[model samples]
Target: MRAGRLRHRITFQVPGEVQDQQTGEMVSGWETVWEKVPASVEALSARDLIAAQAGQSEASGRMVIRYRAGVLPMMRILHRGDAYNIQGPPLPDPDSGLEYLTILVAKGVNDG
Candidate 1:
């Protein structure tokens, strides 16, 4: 992957459980896992978005980043004040598997 393509910055968050202050009950929350990570965010085309919506799939975009381990489908990506839920596991570049990761994401979704 070209360095220029990863011009956007993104943050990754993972789901966590925290205790409620008053009730002392465990509640789902998000914890920052990685911040200010270089990435490339690409919104799906209108046709693709519509087709995915028709199929009841939430995927609306994709984010590419330099190859890193431990990225999972349960993680959430924050970019430009928007929260995107990961649609599936990170996929490596088919041509150069170690170069980068392609993550399917859905915008405007709850992080946890």
Candidate 2:
């Protein structure tokens, strides 16, 4: 992966239970898995967006990051205060699997 292209900073999160400070009750929320991770975020093309939406899928963006284990579909990405739900499992590079991962993401979705 090219370091220059991965200029965008993003955070990876997974769904988990957290204690509500005031109420002392367990609430479902996002737990940070990695913070300030460098990545490349790109928007899907107009045709792709239309097709995804037509199929009841919200995948509208593609984000690429360095290869990391345990990145699941249930995880979400946080960029510039916007939450993006992971559309499917993270895909590794075909030629060199260890190099990077391509993740499909959707904005405005509550993954947690």
Candidate 3:
């Protein structure tokens, strides 16, 4: 990944259990594991496999982010206060000396 492309900052949030104030019961929520991580977010086209599947699933906004490790497939990407559900497992770049992570995500809902 080019360093210049990674100009935006995003957060990686994972599912966790927290006690609900109103219900006094454990509730599922997102907790940031990596915040303000530098990454490059690109709007995906149908050429990408994730975007192809997204089309069938009615996912309008499909994107791919390139960053270092600290996230997983089930986690959500919090960018500019908007949530995007990861579509599948992250693919690590195979190029030498640049161990970047490519994560596929779709906005508005979770596939689960």
Candidate 4:
């Protein structure tokens, strides 16, 4: 099988409580910031998607993504103008499944 090249924008939601210091009042409102993480598929290893992000190679695949250690609760893989949301624990391994590809915007790295 041939590895596919993909690109996607990962968005992260920031959480915080709103409050008014002037009158010590609790503010009720929804505030969120969207961050775009651009990833490029550099190489594919049957088990991983060798991606180039922030001038480095990061392995991303079913298993690697499922068992990713950190604050990545949700991730979306966009390709061909479509988005696929990846969820659940780390994946066991790569399978003969289809993925997507998308055009990412020019932006800085994601420091999450």
* Best model number under TM-score: 2
What RMSD does model 2 have? 2.4
Give the backbone clash total of model 1.
0
TM-score of 1: 0.80
Q: What is the C-alpha RMSD of each candidate to the true structure, in Å?
A: 3.1, 2.4, 3.9, 13.3
Off by over 4 Å in 3: 19-26, 46-67, 110-112
Task: Evaluate model 2: give its lDDT.
Answer: 0.88
Q: Please give the CA lDDT of all the candidate structures.
A: 0.88, 0.88, 0.68, 0.34
Give stretches of model 1 more than 4 Å off.
18-27, 50-56
Q: Give the per-residue lDDT of model 3 (tens digit) for 62-110.
A: 3334545556777888788778887666767677524677666778753
Model 4 weakest 10-residue run by lDDT: 62-71
lDDT of 3 at 37: 80
Worst 10 residues of 3 by lDDT: 54-63
TM-score of 2: 0.85
RMSD of 1: 3.1
TM-scores for every candidate against the unseen true structure: 0.80, 0.85, 0.70, 0.25
Query: What lDDT tens digits, residue by residue, belong to model 2 across residues 1-112?
Result: 7799999999998889988899999999988999999999999998877776755367889999999898998888899989998887888999979999999888976756
The whole-model C-alpha lDDT of candidate 3 against the native structure comes to 0.68
After TM-score superposition, the amount by which residue 78's alpha carbon in candidate 1 deviates from its true location, in angstroms, is: 0.5
- For model 2, the run of ten residues with the poorest summed lDDT: 49-58
